[model samples]
Target chain A: MSPSKSPLIAVVDYGLGNLRSVSKALELTGAEVIVSSKPKDLLSASGVVFPGVGAFYRGMENLRERKLNSALFKIIKEGKPFLGICLGLQLLFTFSWEHGDTKGLDIIEGRVKRFEGNVKVPHMGWNQVKQTQDSSPKTKDLFQGIPDNSYFYFVHSYFVVPKDKSLIAATTEYGGEFTSCVCKENIFGVQFHPEKSGPLGLQILKNFIDIINDSQT
Target chain B: MFSKRIIPCLDVKDGRVVKGINFVNLRDAGSPTEQAKVYSNENADELVFLDITASSDHRKTMLEVVKATAEQVFIPFTVGGGIRNIEDIRTLLHAGADKVSINTAAVENPKLVKDASWEFGSQCIVVAIDAKRKKSVTSNQNPEWEVYTYGGRKPTGIDVVEWAREVESLGAGEILLTSMDRDGTKEGYDLELTRSVSEAVNIPVIASGGVGKLEHLYDGLTLGKADAVLAASIFHYGEYSIKQTKQYLKDKGIPIRL
Candidate 1:
């Protein structure tokens, strides 16, 4: 495929609400965005952004129904940049216990577990995220120009525990340290909503756009 | 670490701002989308657009405002006031509202809270509770708060604490607790009412109404044990910028993003 002047980013629309904010944020970062539920549209894009908010089982069910599962697999296998947000991030893991034992895409080996003990269930609002020291150099580039401990808007009940420790890009302290960001090869996932996270969050999206632009060259 | 949030609330009517915004650089001050852009640029953690429009026909105007704001502003925002059913919530969420708050509707139909949270995620469903101190309490009895409906006009006679617990159990992710007595008086938040409901629920509680000064904001987060504070007048009157408020909270040893 010939490299276009502007990278077209496909935001996977697997029957979830609130894709407007995600697509709008990406558009502001100078990337052409197409909120598409069609699998072929996702495969043709330079980068794919999988964003959703809801139950893990419902999200996977929609993906399978829309045939987005195979498109996502192809995007990752073909080395296209993939960014996942919130439930989009959780769906990349092995499985989740959200409504029951639900299987995920297994792109990353991990279990989506609930927040237990005395802390709040959803873990809503702003929290500081520190980049893990073991993050790879390319993963560190994801946080480029973003200050450490910047606050991001997060609203989630479950957290991911990646089996491969190297995939952990950042950790945040809720009751204890849980993986907030994960990066491996061309895949990146964040538990927080970067679209809703203000400037620093926009910077993360800008960085992803930059990565896509660089790869196209 | 979780930072206590300082959210600025805007009263929008018929897709325009009802309250005066004291910010200097606004091109169109009355436009809700423009004001939202200014607030988001001022480092506001989040925004709440309370549509006080009386007629249900004006909801389409509010949806346009939400769509415009979502297109321009990057921060998270919640739209409340006059939301009645699941269809109303779905439209706002689809139009780019990160969350939709239900007050009178949630009180009237408790099952709406359960069904809405079940359909959309609980994280996007915020149940706003307007509570007033129950009158005629004897000296021997502990002071209690009664839930008010229809924008704090009618008393529901329901215990504020019990209502908060019920909504949380019904799958509310957060509670926007507003004290009616202290709303316009500006003395301070009813710390007792706030703490009781905050301590009773496992979800995050946002203390609303009666923030006269920076100290009042500090007290609400500390003594009231609230996860966030929502104020309209203080930020509107140019009394303090969001950065100044966060700085004060941070100095008071409260965990806030600077």
Candidate 2:
């Protein structure tokens, strides 16, 4: 695929997110990116990404205010690939109990809950992720050719528990078994920050870009 | 699992690696790029280049040396000394440095730590502290050590442990603590100093200065609770190799990359 035809990945910047690092990582994979807060830019892109770092409620509220809620739903329903990272993943769940009872995107039938275990709250540093479901090209496409238990960087205080077990693409042992990654049809999310996961993280992004490029061919 | 790291630090002056006996009587080791390539071949996890001179003429020369060394060495490297502003950090990082270590500048202007962390992320900012034992003069004097700046030339008069906690809160990703008393002594790391600073901050602590043998590396990790061990004279003078040090640590059941 030509560089221009390769899907322009839209990294949504809703005024509060770590978009620079994510954008730089994607750019390293030879993917053209447009970091935009405009609904038109997000809707026109081939792939949409919801990248966030802070509270889920604030993120969802920003998206709704910008009319990106309808734009994202329309794009996802169109069967185009979508990736959610960290808070972006939490926003996909039905609701979150972070500061109060806050509703999420409800795209996936899951609830985001605070970490309740003996392990540390942030779950910082490097940790291993074990693959559970083999569906979705992201399973082998994103994590392709890597070791079964390759370590990825993680920094979070909450995790998602999908109501449907089929959506759980990977699980990791933090305090216990917790969903580290999830995928459903064209929608996918990772609890950990892949951009900061070092070489393994870079490979996952490369795979995602390759899949996007292949779709055009 | 994350493997433990072994690092070698080179004190550079006028674009050349220099080693001093007891922090004085400096002698040129070799070209910075040549020495860095040798360490890279030996499987050193990371390398630290500290510019020991304070000359403006030498700083530009060192920048060129860093660019050349970074071109040859692929492993993560940190450059320190006389970094006063964000532009200096940006220049070094653009020249292929994975991280930048700030000492005197960070202490002089604490806000620089936050600014650098914001600009290049927390993982790229490392704070280096030179600590020395303070003799108790009066009953009211604090028991903690004192912090020094300007290549250990001037005393900052700040409590070492307190300053470590403050810097970490200011957004330093890691702390490279060197014991001025034990440096170049080839005895062992100052476990008391290392343990004190490691316990003071949440970030990783790299123990530098006195690392004479393999046991010293293990001592830093196990006893001192250091995230990484840094040596100079032993590695620079060819007394020990990075591979040998890592092998010893691995054999001792310590988590290290071989």
Residue A180 displacement (Å), model 2: 3.9
Candidate 2: which pairs clash?
Answer: none
Model 2, span B59-124: residue lDDT tens: 888778766765455456789988999999888776656578999999999999998876665666
lDDT: worst 10-residue window of model 2 chain B = B20-29
- Across A1-217, the per-residue lDDT of candidate 1 in tens digits comes to 2233568999999887699989989988778999999988999999999999978888988888987788888899999999999999999999998878899999999999999988987988899999987678767778998888889999999999999998999999999899999999999999999999988999899889888987877
Q: Model 2: DockQ against the native? A: 0.10
What's the lDDT for all of these models?
Answer: 0.91, 0.77
TM-score per candidate: 0.98, 0.68
Which regions of candidate 2 deviate over 4 angstroms?
A: A1-79, A83-125, A133-137, A153-167, A171-179, A190-199, B6-80, B83-100, B109-125, B137-143, B169-172, B231-247
